[model samples]
Target: MPSADGGTTSLPPIPLALGGDDPCTAASKRTAERASWAQKSLSLPHAWKLSQGEGITVAVVGTGVSVDAPALEGRVTAVGDAGDDCVGHGTFIAGLIAAAQSKGTDFQGVAPAARVLGVRGTDERGTASVGLIAAGIRTAVDRGAQVVSVASALTTGKEELTGAVRYATKRDVLVVAPVAPDGETRPTDAPVDTYWPASAPGVLSVAGVAANGTVLRSADGAGEADLAAPGGAVVGIGPRGAGHFIAAGSSAATAFTAGAAALVRAYNPDLTAAETAKRLISSGPPTGDAARLDPYAAISVVTDGTRSPASAPEESKPLKLPVMSSTLQDRAMVVAGGMAMLVLLVAAAAVVIPRGRARGWRRP
Candidate 1:
């Protein structure tokens, strides 16, 4: 079985568990309580007040999603045998995208009202080729998916996958792909190279960001990361019978971005795929690596014409975003202190230069 992104295509490496046996060994740990943290971090609650990604369909093209998961109930439309996910990666991704938290828990997904079209690109053993992933994308598009989430990365370029991405984009479907999880031990047969279709053109590549909005993986220092999202310490359902998994990786980040896209699309149904992708990158707050996804800001950009769709340049053109710099902050703070001292000197009769913690003040 060739890895989709050239490394071992087993289950997504979910090693961080809040309370469980081993890292990924825990089968039934409920993480509903932790979902609020991620939601609040992304401001999903406020974004949902505007749109819960209603009337939008996101095709999760990865490991199959288990439809029977309690959090995902009534939110998934499995295409074929997608209801069964042995690796639980697909289900986890789907839960992030569209899990309905009707269970009165904090586990509400980014786009709880959105519909998830689960497409099983990988087999039971969590193995898939780039061609299979491409097929899954096309299938999701054919099934009326407005957004297509490609969870796997491919080491080698495949024309089929490229064509599939092009096909979806042509029809106004946003294609979101995450860089494959870094630091996982690659199989000896796996290729040592950058992952694709994330590296492919026309795909919205996302980098994983920790809760503090920092790029989680140091290797994401490449040009492929178009945007960043909260992927670290994410909580989502695994298979139906199994409990939740507190996972962290680029895959989770990609799902959150995809869910944001669904919300943007639902808010402005007429925006093209290029427009949506551009809005996400242009509206987000820039970190050192990439823009941290701001769902509310993106929606506001669309609704308020911060950058009108017509004014946006061609998709191939470069986007200039403001860099968040600590040096600039320090300089601003120093300038502010000097201004405050000047104001104090002007208000008082004399300049006060007391020092040494007021141990002794020399008379001038």
Candidate 2:
């Protein structure tokens, strides 16, 4: 079984004097309450104004998420008797995608109102076989998940997984998978073509980027990297509501992208899965280091049929009257008359200067 890393390498150090009113505790709480930088970078707030992924069901397939996590309180639903999670990687991804503000903190998920289906494809140790993961994908899709997020990438391409991907695609369910982060420490050195599920046809492969919108050094170059999103220095809820921890990897980036996809679906229920993916591609920034997600742009394209969403009305405003053709024609005539006068002056100057010079008849 290949071990999937959820990327939560370390949890921030906790202060010894932990109290609700303690300064350190208060500071930590404040940071946790603030919306994540990834969400802000993706313009999720503006996107939220259009849609909160209200009717979309996002399936998180990986290590099990803590269904009881405070931030995930009402949004998580477990499928079958999936095993418990010890690594908490799945929980963090869940939090990134759908966590809501809790305990006086303000850090809300990208699609805070979207529902999550937690499918425990991996064991307690966070390792799973190709078959298990493939099963998880199909189960999520079969259970009515509009978006299935597979947080792990494997080198060994399994027939079951490929079939599952095609199954989801044919059903118009968006399947998102992470491209293995590139580097010496990458989980698999497998060729990009062999990145199972991610390389599968119709699956959207995501890459990781830092706060400055630069692709991480460990980013996966395989799967053609469909899109990139903020992944570095990510803060998310820990297992069983322990607290928030920082993580980095393509897994987090995939979660963010999945949330963006959910927003598009929620904004326009009429958009087919293919149309939603196209909306994201059309709004996504250039790929690789400069690739950045624009959730508002993507949502607007689907909701308003434009590249950018029209600004919201401020205060009580009256609609302005449309400009009339007569007004436009008058302006055009004024401009034409000015140009005509300028041409006349220039012609007169040309004639007068040459005549004056000729009359002088002196090589001054």
Best by lDDT: 1
Write the residue-wise lDDT of candidate 1 on 1-364 in tens digits: 1111222222233432123222323355443444445677788877888888989999999778777777777778888887766667788788889887744356767888899998987765566677778889899989999999987776765577778888887888888987655333332344444666776667888878776666765335434477888776666767654355566778788999999999999998888888888888888877775778899888876423333221332344466998869999899899999999988877663434444326675556
**Model 2 C-alpha lDDT per residue in residues 134-248, reported as the tens digit of each score:** 9899899899999988888888756778898889989999998877643325564444445677777778777887777767666644545777887766777765653666667
Model 2: number of clashes?
Answer: 5
Off by over 4 Å in 2: 1-10, 13-33, 181-184, 188-193, 289-291, 302-364
Clashing pairs in 2: 33-105, 33-106, 33-107, 182-218, 182-219
**TM-score to native of every candidate shown:** 0.73, 0.74
- C-alpha RMSD of each candidate structure in angstroms: 11.4, 11.4
Off by over 4 Å in 1: 1-29, 102-104, 182-193, 303-364
- What is the lDDT of every predicted structure here? 0.73, 0.71
